[model samples]
Target: MLHLMIAIPAFARMYNVSCKMCHVAFPKLNGFGQAFADNGYVFAGKQGEIYRNLGDDRARTFKELPLAVRFTHYVAASYDGGKAMTDFQSPWSVKFLLGGAPNERINFYAYVIFEKGLPPFFEDAWIDLHGFFGLPFSLTLGQFQISDLMFMRETRLTRSDFYIYKVGPYKITYHRGALLGTPIGDFGVVNGNGLSALNGKYYDDNPSKWFFGHLPLPADFGLFGLWGEDYDTLGNYVRLYRLGLDWRGVFESFYPFFQILVGFDNDTSNLFYGGFFGVDYAPGGDGVVSLLFNYVDAPANSPYRNERLATLALRYSHYVLTNLKVFAEGEGWLFKRSLALTLGVDFAF
Candidate 1:
């Protein structure tokens, strides 16, 4: 399943506002949406503070559970190498999503998956506390993607992925960690082992950790670095470093974004580099068209060798309602010499 993230409809229900207040579409955030997130999942001032606690003085609770569901269902057809295939992949992913202010200073976000496996799993479960100790900083602790600080796919408008974040040679996306940051910048240290660490009771057999620092630059640009010194499963000594730069711009109805990263590993003698460029164009009413291209260049020792790897995708999404969108995308996976077309629906409510 290709994971999908959303600006949950719960906010719309709680604030009594239209979904468009934060989203240009179901998952694509507008400028106001970025501000809402920066302000602890609420509107500026006291508008988002209108909720009344259902609990007593000592505890604050919601009058209604602030929860929503997001899912994807798709039909994919592709020709890879010499093989051609077509299939129905309905319910590609189903998520129980929730996020909101638990109190004045704390906003939390999480999503649990219900795919093929029983006893569903959590993809994101983090609490963000603003103005900690009455200072200018914030704190976040839980499981999340470090890549978000560099180039967040959660708010992107494409059905395809930002492949750089998933590249094996410089991988640094998922884990459990504590982050100290503000809107301008953040620093974090997470278990260097990825999701495996979270599944293993957040335990680490090695003492090393992954360290990351991100700073926002002027003009909607950002820079970040990730460092890791750890041992591989086979006990091979490893030291990895990554540097990324991201930028985004909006011209009326068109929004364009670009992100690139360079990574090196001393132990494996591997060097990796890649980036993705995408643009979203909303000409008018209820519809969005997006184009994305991701490319990677890896050393010969890496899985993707020779720099002959890339993916190009074009997608169109139409909102039938605020919480439901139907989309179709045509993609070329240059790495596998495959071409695909997928018809899908995304629902968030």
Candidate 2:
């Protein structure tokens, strides 16, 4: 899903602005885009009172019921074992999104989706309230991603993934709990569990830590170190910790980023360390090219079994319109001698 997006069109329609106002590319938040989101989806200068309905004193109202839809279709090919296989996974997914800000202080967003090979369900429904008890930080009391504090998967540039999230040690999905985000840093607690058949409501976050999970600095560098007690595959609760460093930079049309982590699982003294580096380049007003390289290694007895992965991916996206995009991608595994290719279309309105 993100390092996923708002190509929802509703935001542009609501604010009477162009999509580019918030995105360097569709789904990728620009500086102003990040600001708009940080402001609880409201304009920074004012509360946007003139844009709201007048009938609400007890509850907030929207000038319009903000809504949008996103659809993805793709054709792909990949090397499996020693042969090439074709995949016609068109209409990969369809998503219905609803998001709105009633005022400057509160905002909400969620989505329902029907994905291929998956049950239709709703996900990522959360409300964000700005300024907690007159504090400078915001409190998000709902579901979000812990990895979001670092490299957000839903808002990424490539169809491939980061080493830390995909197969390394972490997971990419929804976590239910609360988060406090400030200008310089952010800290939060989450269920420490992935979504399941019951929506994982029976689970809860371990809240005893802060400066604990993910930390990114304004200097284009980041540090992460956190510990948690959770169950292993054997259904026994165990202690685990992850530590890492990351950095990124931008130079005109080029942007590059990197992340590395070392983790110990289930009280194992042996550790696994790895990371990924990637770049995004905008060579034209409506097109972006992206490249990624990832590698990770783990101990033999560790859950990761000292597994190693080395892959490279490249992608190019062209904006057919502000809310529509077409893309193609190619990926190769260095050790496995495998390759994958995809041509896809992603559109929203």
Candidate 3:
């Protein structure tokens, strides 16, 4: 069954020659191994023809409200210390989505998720303001994933899949607020705040000589940091601060990826401290047979390291079908090391 699921998508991704040509139900999780193969081995993106209709041609044609919907479903089961199960059971999730560019300079996407046995909830809702201030900078405000040092993906090495276990507290939540992204020289700097008041900064209206490096591979090696405070209307609040190091060209090309993160949390009475380490291959833009690894050390030190959970994962994805996608993935955890292998197929339309 897994072989068949992947085979079809692998052929399709190779045939299309475009990754985003086939839209994914979950832009974050990507799809099954084979589905990726069918889409040319790339994650979903806005540049593909599948969403090319979102450009000016369609925007100008419609003057009223415009919308797009995305849906996703997953049924995965695994066996670690227990016997192998026959059917998909263990973990399952469904999601509803809507998004599109309603105007020439603005675009947005939202996702609401419904877990198998939890309360139906809204997962993410954020908007991007493009070409604002007549500069290359834009402000995104909403309750969405924090665009800090990590790329939100299950690929292990990307941000240390800290909260994969159902009961693990390592899972992160999207915070509410705004971010400022500007191109400083050839690099970029993105300053974000959790609360509205703290969004103010000296460079809000002006450009700086600073630079932002590429992901997986930041151009210049340096240290980055983040601090945030969340408050209610009455002034009661919670505060968190994080420090990260961005390393460049640190190892051989075979395993040329590395990053480190430390965080402190404060909530009036207590403080907590936590940290994570990630090491993987390069971006694998075209296709690199590589391995990705992540490990998170979380402690319950008052508010600084509030999560108090530990997680580790390893994953490998390849482009056997073409630049689109191909191959499969399997992940396990020490908590419930007996039953959780996710076999999926990825593809693009």
Candidate 4:
């Protein structure tokens, strides 16, 4: 369970650093590495028990305990048909994330879920209120993670063509209130929400913004809007929104990506869209080979019925030894309707 092959560079040469700093993995195929105790090995030492348990020793001073934690698990097996037909199962989802930053503006985030069939939910709780002075802004409140610019592209366990509209397609699932983000250094802007629960069910995007222009890519953009209430009856849902853009580079060695999304819900005016395109080929980075294509479109008059989804995926990650990682992902769906699949492995302690 902690073999990461040979303990991932023997714990990065006993801590000299440079396993990609924390590894994004390459070459070492089959068994990739770096879970570092699922992300709370804190920098590996658990840093004095995470600063004696979430820091903050009164006198409210300097910044030191911006606690951080992450745990993600997805065990999978799937095959299902339209309207719930065929069968095959073995499912799992476990996510626990806690974040920090006690002051200098304040910040804390959360997402706790232990799922097998449902019930545990917190997909992301929030608190971000950076002092604001113009370009540096924040005001998150509760329930998070719905910033879609293709939401980090894919490869996070498997993004099953966005699960028809669930897993991500037009994700509006996490809702509770407050939004605003602006860091504008690696890109920024995540805009507002809540007027008595999305007033319409979601996407009138009182303020939604996402931008990126660097880091493994040369383009990125996202905006999720709202004009809610129409889950199953009535009208005028009329306003829903999503705009995403992504572009990846590295042509000589191959690493392409693309994403696009559009959604509209004018009650029965219905209109939704989705897209995905992927390519990853690593030659010297260890192991990575991916290909993906996705599309979603279906929603015309609406008694709530839309179809036109397509998906294809293949993934492989390797690192036979060192910090260990071995991955596999496969998915196929065509024409119209449903079908999905997933496979997983991640260990980095």
Model 3 misplaced regions, further than 4 Å: 1-17, 20-87, 96-104, 117-121, 154-172, 184-223, 230-238, 247-256, 267-290, 298-310, 317-340, 346-349
The estimated TM-scores of all candidates read 0.91, 0.89, 0.53, 0.31
Can you write out model 1's per-residue Cα lDDT over 1-349, one digit (the tens) per residue? Answer: 0011236788888877888888877677777776778777756665435566655666776656789988888999999989999999887889998888876678898999887435688878888877767877778888888888866677777878898888773366778888887656788999876656334453666788889888888898888898888876678888888889999898998988999998877744577888999999986588889999999887778644655479999999988987798999999987788999999998888
Which residue pairs clash in candidate 1? none
Candidate order (lDDT): 1, 2, 4, 3
Better structure of 1 and 2 per lDDT: 1
Which candidate's TM-score is highest? 1
Segments in model 4 whose C-alpha atoms lie over 4 Å from true places? 1-48, 52-56, 59-144, 147-155, 159-237, 240-264, 271-307, 312-333, 336-349
Clashes of each: 0, 11, 44, 45
Writing each residue's lDDT as its tens digit, candidate 3 over 216-258 gives 3247454555554444245555454555554534354343434
Between candidates 1 and 3, the lDDT winner: 1
By summed lDDT, the worst window of 10 consecutive residues in model 2 runs over 203-212
Candidate 1 has its poorest 10 consecutive residues by lDDT at 1-10
- Which candidate comes out best when scored by lDDT? 1
